[model samples]
Target: MNATNSQSPTIVLVHGALTDASVWHGVIRLTQAAGHHVVAPSLPLRGLASDAAYLESVPGPIVLVAHSYAGSVISHPATLDPKVKALVFIAAFQPDAGESSAELNERFPGSKLGPATTTVVPRPGGNDMYLKPEAFGEVYAGDVAPDVVSVMAAAQRPIDPAALGETLPARATWHDLPSWALVSTRDLSLPPQLLGFTARRAESHIVEVESSHAVPVSHPREVTEVVLEAVRCALS
Candidate 1:
């Protein structure tokens, strides 16, 4: 490969909370076939620092792509490398410096858009909650595949509610990297508008899909297109 093509950007898939990297299974093959390398890790579910550290172990100069709560996991500098060329968020939270996911839950009274699960757990490693599946499809990712959503609801690992309460000590590449975002119009959890707000911080190239929050599974073609674009950007 030529020198320019020699450094093709790799796509790092970061799945949201209560799920593992398997959540991205569908898109991986397509990405690799399209001529990009891909790496997605299972966040330790341990805590914020450990999870970020785990992700940092992946090869550098990555095009980090995150979905749902996984976006927060990628916000750390340890998980972030200098060669990381860009970021792509799929209905994911891309917070600016000194910002927390709490801002997403900073509800205006009567605002009906928040995680609807009755139980929220605080894992020792980070902030995440294992909400019920029915409650999940009803709230967080109603648009996801039924079977996968069922599995996610049933096997959801506990997340530390305190993960949100405590702040990380690093920067998200959104401030500097070339970024892109995929937003769903029918999302009930984070509301489409709220996603717009989170996306603004990214200064990203946005793709408004008419689907719901579980965008990767629901709209693989669209998600793949965005990933392709990010790879092209990074490799350029």
Candidate 2:
């Protein structure tokens, strides 16, 4: 990891399935206000390997922040990149080699997400899974305003079912790098227990918050604080 210098390291934010980069907007503003370089890229919800390959293209030596499924993406090339100094997971998954996210989601099985989603959309490569518009507020963003949830649901991106079932790469970056994880206590999409399990498995410095799966959106300040902690460690 690079020592603290005159310039802050770049911070790349990765969003998970059923959402786009816009989900990071709240956190982006907080990072920007703190004078850090931030980039929240949209991860195509095609599959894990492909998405990681795409994220690997970003110039790194960065503090990588990943939410939900994007957690799997950052665990590969981006996390392994010498340029990547720290990893921050926000109510995200941390699957190991040979482990599939679908299985992980069912590992504890307390999530309301399965029932909240619909798989009626047929895409080119595979079926697209989406959180039902009516269920979005209750399942994904319980703490968010109704109006905001409305907009989020309308703009929601459907994830390829294949992505959810994709096994992780042979290797993972979190195994080597220092990591921080934020667990949303109120999250129904990715249960807090599952998040805690993954975080502990990764040996991440963890903090729990009373928020939802959309913690980055509903509690940006807290999320930014954790990201900043990883940044501090990266530069130390």
Candidate 3:
């Protein structure tokens, strides 16, 4: 391959709370099949600042893909970094300055997530949380198979409460970069209208799908297509 052609921008996938990088398994497979480099790093789910810093540490010129709460991370330095060429949000939170995942979760009227979740104190000063296993399948991954949802529920990560309430920095790459979004119409974790609000605010190229919040797992083809679109934009 010529040097120019060999230099495809890397696709960095960031997973949100209640799930680890494993959530992007299907999306990674499809992106890799399309001959693009892809990496899904585990977000700490401790706080947005730490997660964003971790994402920023990756060498860039990357197509940054954020799922769920991760949208908040990539919007900042994760996208603002000079190496980030474009951004793709898959049913993710995209908060502006002074906004937060906790705030946005209640911004619209469709989400049933808050009541379904329960918290556990991970330490003396803070807490970590997870969705009730019974509600996990219906709310977060409705389109996924039953067996898979069972496995996902068993392995779901606990997100630190700080991550959700942490306010964002003053600036975000979405405010200035080329961006694309996959709006999951069936998403109960982050409602479709809420996703629409964020995507429109960022002026992102939008594609709507009838999947749940776990769109990467339930609608990998759709997620992959959006990622490829961002990759094409980065390459151009």
Superior by TM-score: candidate 1 or candidate 3: 3
The digit string of per-residue lDDT tens for model 1 on 109-198 reads 222334555476544444456666667676655677678788767876555665554455766767667888888777765567877877
User: Which residue ranges in model 3 land beyond 4 Å of their true spot?
Assistant: 1-5, 77-79
Q: Give the TM-score of candidate 1.
A: 0.84
Could you tell me the lDDT of residue 75 within candidate 3? 80
Q: Flag regions of model 1 displaced more than 4 Å.
A: 1-6, 107-116, 121-128, 168-171
- Residue pairs with colliding backbones in model 2 are 61-83, 61-84
lDDT tens digits, residue span 1-236, model 2? 23324467789999998888999998888778777888887877887888887877777568889999988888764358788888999999988888877899898866887853654588666778888989889889999999999999999887887888888757678898999999999989888999999999999999999998999889999999999889888878
Look at candidate 2 and tell me the lDDT of residue 21. 92
Q: Spell out the clash pairs found in candidate 3.
A: 61-83
Question: Model-by-model lDDT, in order?
Answer: 0.71, 0.85, 0.85
List the candidates ranked by TM-score, beginning with the highest: 3, 2, 1
**Residue 125's C-alpha lDDT in candidate 2?**
62
Better by TM-score, candidate 2 or 1: 2
Cα deviation at 128, candidate 3, in Å, is 1.0
Model 1 RMSD, rounded to 1 decimal: 3.5
How do the predictions measure up, each by TM-score? 0.84, 0.94, 0.94
**TM-score of decoy 2:** 0.94
